[model samples]
Structures are given as C-alpha cells and as structure tokens.
Target: MTGLRPDTGRQAGTMLIVFGVVLLVSSLVVSAALAPSVGAAGNDGTPQTLVGSQGGGPGLHESGSVYLLDGKETKWKAAETDSYFDVTMLDNGSVATGFMDSGYEDCEPYESPCTHTGFRILEPTDDGGAEIVYEYSFPVRTRSNSEVHDVELLDSGEFLVSDMEYERIFTVKNGEVTWQWNASSMYDAPADPTTTDWLHINDVDALSEDRYLVSVRNANQLVVIERGEGVVEVINKDENGDGTGDPEVLLQQHNPQWLNNGSVLVADSHNDRIVELHRNNTTDEWEVAWAVYEAEGVPFSWPRDADRLANGNTLITDSLNQRVVEVNESGMTVWSYKTPYVPYEAERLPEGETVGATTYAVNEDATVYGNGDVPVLSLLLILFQTGIQVPFWFTELHVGVTLVSLTMTIAGTVLIVRDR
Candidate 1:
C-alpha cells in the first residue's frame, strides 16, 4: 500500500519549492555576469534603473526644458523636414541647429524640394515659440555639393555648416553661403575614398576665420583644412622638398570640438575616448596638446558627441551605453545618467554651467520596474546563475540569455535610480 500510493501533498510541495529556488538562482547569476561592466551616472555604486523613454524632452544634467530633435521628428517642431544633426547656442541667446529639410523654403525664397539644404538657425520668440531667423542655403551658380551636418553662429548672423556628404564646408551670413570650403579639392578622391561603410565625413569645428578642424571617420583622421575664397588649402603632408608641414598623419578620431583656450576636443569613437589637442589650434600652427579617454577608468561603450564645459568639466554622450557622463578635469565622474536609450549628442547649458555642463540623457527607467519586495542584488545574482537564458524568454543562445540578464538587472537598477 505504501509503495503504490497516490502522489502525496508533501512531495508536491517539495517539488514546487525546488523549482522556484532553481529558477530564481539562475536568473540572478545571468544578470550579474552581463551587467554593464561600468556603472552609469548618478548610479552611486549601485545598479540603478534606466528611466524615461528615448527621445523624451527633459533635462538630465540641468534645469529647464530641452529636447533633442533626432532628425526623425524635427518637422513636427517647425524646423520642418530636415533631420537634425548638430545644435549650438548662439551668443545672442538663440539656438543654432544643423539639419537637412527636403522642401526647404529658403531665405532668398529659392524653391521647394531643395534637396538636402543646409543648417537652420532658430531664434527664441517672445511667446516661447521659435522663429527660423536664418536658413543657410547655397548661392545660385555656386559649385558645391548638398547636405550639411553642423552649425555654429559665426557672429550675430554668420555661421559655419559642415556639408559632410558633398565634402564641402559652407560659410553663411544672413541666410546665404558667402564662402565655401571644398573638401574634395584637398583629397585625391574628395575624402580618401569612402570606407566600405560609406562615409568619411564627420564633425567640423572652427579654429579661426581662415582655418578649421575636420573629422573624417572612415579615414580615421583629423586634419586642418584652410579655407580661402576660390581655394581650399590642405596641409596633408610636408612630403616633397620642404619642412613646411606634418603629413596629416592618422590621428584616430571621429569628432573634434573647440575650446576657448585654443585647445581641440576630439571624440575617439572606436577607442571609446575623447582627446584634447592644443598648441596650433586657434589659427594656423596647430598641433595636438594632450589626450583624454573615457573619463579615467569609465570606458564608454560607444561615445559620440562631447563638449568642454566652462567649469573645467567634459560632458560626454556615451551613445551605446545609453548615458551622458560628466567628468571634472581631475577625471572624476561628477555626474552620470544611464538613460534608457541612445543619446547621440550632449551639450552643457550655460545658464546651468554653475553646475557644470547641461545634458539631456534619454532615460527609459520604468519599462520593467521592480517592486521593493525583491532584493536588487539577489534579483541580479539569480538572472545570471546558469550563465544561460532563464527560459522564460524562449531563447537558447548564451548571448541572448546574457541580454535577458541585462534586462533584469536594469529592472532592479531603476529601483535605486531616484535615490542616486
């Protein structure tokens, strides 16, 4: 009778306990192993929640309403059609954003469907609305290509636009391309031939009235292109018969920004770093001064746009890491935010400069929030326990499993974010 008994309640209870324990243990382990090797800004040494959806307008680094128009939706904001690439604040309190609008209604009132026009400089209106005071467009009969990536107010109305694809740099004033810098003229093939990945053109920053700093990603090089009316003088090499120049030797870089002190700030994307180059930066006679990387031990997963703050700090967009990191000159991460989605660019708000640079990290923190009942670390430990998938997600690959672990860890992370 004892051997041929029905399934007992005690045995059933034991199996349930065993299964729950094993499942939980496995989840925590997977989560811990694949947790982002480095912690995010405002993390405070604990796994914090990823907050806010990507592209939502909020100030992650300062106070005031700010939004990043990621080229996809700037049209809705009246900077119609152009996908925005770069933005900067002008000396007169207006903001200049570089974007490409398809059906551009130009300052000269040129025509519609202008095909990838230049930057749009927006001035603040008295009622919180915006007015497009300047829309820089190429002059008629001007021989140059289309498409621009960045914009900076040259004076009150003059500006610089980095026309990346066409390999041209356009100088604008009161909505006209006054002078042009042809990048194709300097190179054998107008930019060392596009890499198999399709582009070499990147960020461009002004050094002075006649000199410039240009980032060519595919070539993985940064060189100065001297702009003059009717000619673009390039100093690629001092190769033949003279001590005239240093061959624009390959300096691994993607984006280069300018500092007021004649120093250049560069974003080394592949290496995940930002460098500072000075010496001959302001006018001609420019040379690299020093280099900085990923805010000391905090390696960025994929750092993109960066800026040097007036208070001696650097605001960096750790793109793939989905965060914005602020590092003081001492290399301490004074602030950070593990935003929920990719942050392509970060700028410091001058009004908020007393707190350092301003940045708006796209946060997605509450997507998978956890209740306080769960122990954050324990939840993490269990996710990665098996070094495999937790099975609930229906994947077999360890990498996929590892990703799930990341998700769980983020869930626990958000729980502690506001505290940080």
Candidate 2:
C-alpha cells in the first residue's frame, strides 16, 4: 500500500476537518435566517384560540399540554398529561379534550407503569392555569394508537369518544357506555383489533342528535353514521376491493369538518395539505374543490387539523411545523402563531367551527403551493420529524449541507488513520 508524506496527510486531514466544521456552522446560520416570524399576536383581532398539543412522542416519552392562547401568548395552560388531542370549547367556557398519561395501576395485559387514556373537561382559572373538573378515563395495554383521540359533548349530556383501544366510537354517560359503533361491523374484522393498530379511529364529530361523522384514519375514509343504522355514507370509499380507500382523495386524514350537505374540509395529513371536497351533484362523488400545500412559504409538515372558520378563513394546526395558521380563501395566510413541539388540533373561539359556509369553487388549474423536495431526502426528513421535533426552517438546503459535512468528516478520519 502506498501512503502520502506525513506532513501532506496531516495537512489534508486538518483541512477536511476545518471545512466540515465550517459547513456545519454555516448550515446553522442559514436555518436561523430562514426562521419564521413569531406571527401576529392577536393584532388582527383574532379570537382566543384553544390548542391541544400531542407532545414530542408517545406515552411517557414527552409531555403534552392543553392551553388557551391570545395570539402567541399563553393565557392558560394545562400540561399534566403525555398527550392532548382534540379540544372543544364548551358553552359554559370550559374546554373538553382527550388525553393520555402513564404511571397508573391495573395495567393488565401489559407491564407496570402503564398508560391511561380518556377525556377531561378543564375550567380555566384566573391565574393563568386550569383545573380538571371532570374526567373519565381507562387503562390501556399500550400507549400508541390506544388513546381516545376525540371527544364531543352531546345534547343528551353524554360524551362521545373515539376509542382506538377497542376500535369503536361510543358515547358514555356517567361512566356507562350508552352507545357504540364498532369498526368491525362495517369494515373487515381483524382477529384482534386491540392487539395492533387496526383501524385507528381517531376522530368523531356529532353531526346531529343521532348522526355522527367518523374518521377511520388507517382506512383513509370517513363514514357518516346514523343511530340504529350502520354506515349511511362513506367518503373516499374503496371501490377496488382494497382494504384502504383512495389515497388521492384522502390518506390517513384527520379532523374532517362537515361544511354543509355538499362540502367538507379535511386535513389530508399524509398528503401534507388541507383539502376541501365538494360533492359533485351530478355524479354524487366528492371532488377536491380547493387545496393548499403550503402556508407562509413553509411546506405543511403533517397537518392534522383544518377547520373552516365562520369568517371564511381556515384555521389549521400544522403539527410538525409547530404552528397554527389562519388563511383566507385565496390561500393567503392572514394570521399565524408559533407553537411548542407538536400540536394536534386548534380551534378559534367565540364562533368556533360552525357548519355551512359559502363554499368557494376554484378553477381546476388554481395555484397550489409546492416544495421542490428530493424524494428520498424528503422521506428521511419526514421520518425524523415524526419521531423528534425538527426546526421549521430545516429545509433541503440544510440537509444538503449536513450531508456534505458528514462526508468531509468521514474523509478526514480516513486520512488521519492512513497517516498513522
């Protein structure tokens, strides 16, 4: 084997090391330069907003919170759990949301330090805090995909909950199950739905006293269920006999808002966009009326909730982006607020999310935001982002820089070893 002179090898190694450090530092500077603004602090006369954060990871790994915000300022906070999911502001000024926490007893089928999942009603105090006035929870074997992801207060004084543990949508009154619609009845039944994440029924919204809109996330479909009757209608129905629905229509979607009888708004989570679908009266099929892929120049990173506000704007919880944004009909961001870690859902106060707005129809060739991301790099970044919180400004440029830095560092190590 041939080797370079001692001084030459040392010089090359040192130069490579210096270049690697410079590239790494430069990437950090670029990331800071591209950082988003803290956003409008209620200056736009936006109403108070309620946010549910799902923390950084699964149960016991990260701590989540439910908070009330006036713009970017936290007016009240409740952070006693591992994750906080769907949130609703009640008529009496209290908030109802789903939550998960660990360190509970009677964790059967699993080991000690198990998790509990359920819904709680929180009342805000005058001292920038909240107290859980009412709670109804149960122990789960595992933390992932076993929590109650949504809760709604019904007119009959019962709580409608989405139970992922049993793969069912049920209403509970005074700790008793009043009613339930199991997924196995409609879809193909698994041997054991509780053993794995079978359906991931994450959301349930009471459309009427007896009608409910349910989001079957893993199936990539939403079903409208009427009491006593099974699935009345299926949006994004699987026509090809496949177990999952059409991804082009919806893929692992969340928090779908029923906007009138003809249209609906959904956060197409896996597609990284907010989509508005209108029922084609002629064909009786749902079509994308409008969609936005990005807001405030940042590509949406796994947006989990989108609500069509009463003021014709849409409130979106951009989960991985760690911000909530309100955008006008033209896809222009009207107001934005930076949040901490990952946020699962957000709602604008006072008017909240009311049904039926003047649906806007856009041309088929309307402008849509697109981020020119490399395919493999984008996937890697997404996996990293879902597991850990990445900075909003960490873009392809940063990825490129980091890769170059790693290559240089490896080369430097090789050179030093050869010299030795």
Best by lDDT: 2
> Candidate 1 local accuracy as lDDT?
0.47
Where does candidate 2 stray beyond 4 Å? 35-38, 41-44, 57-61, 362-377
- lDDT at 218, model 1: 50
lDDT of 2 at 140: 89
lDDT for each candidate structure: 0.47, 0.84
Give each model a TM-score.
0.54, 0.92
- Residue 7, model 1, lDDT: 39
Q: How close is each model in CA RMSD to the real structure? A: 14.4, 2.5
